[model samples]
Target: MNNKTKSILYGTLASSILLGVYFTVLTLVSGWSFTQ
Candidate 1:
């Protein structure tokens, strides 16, 4: 594999992971607010 391809793959993976964590935190916060 080339350097460019590897970097693209890594960037996509990191962004997806960050987005997942962001949404999870958002959902939990909303849920807690609803309970209170």
Candidate 2:
């Protein structure tokens, strides 16, 4: 894989993990409800 492709993959993975952590924290704080 090229440097560009590796960078893109890493960026995407980091963003997704951050998003997942944000959502999980939000859900826990909101008592497992999607509506916040």
lDDT of candidate 1 over 1-36, digit per residue (tens): 999999999999999999999878877888766544
Candidate 1: Cα lDDT at 29: 80
For each candidate, what TM-score against the reference? 0.81, 0.81
Candidate 2 structure lDDT: 0.89
Residue pairs clashing in model 1 are none
Please report how far candidate 2 places residue 4 from its true position, in Å.
0.5
Q: Largest lDDT belongs to which candidate? A: 2
For model 2, the superposed segments whose C-alpha errors exceed 4 Å read 34-36
lDDT of 2 by residue, 1-36 (tens): 999999999999999999999888888888765744
The lDDT of model 1 is 0.88
- Model 1 scores a TM of 0.81
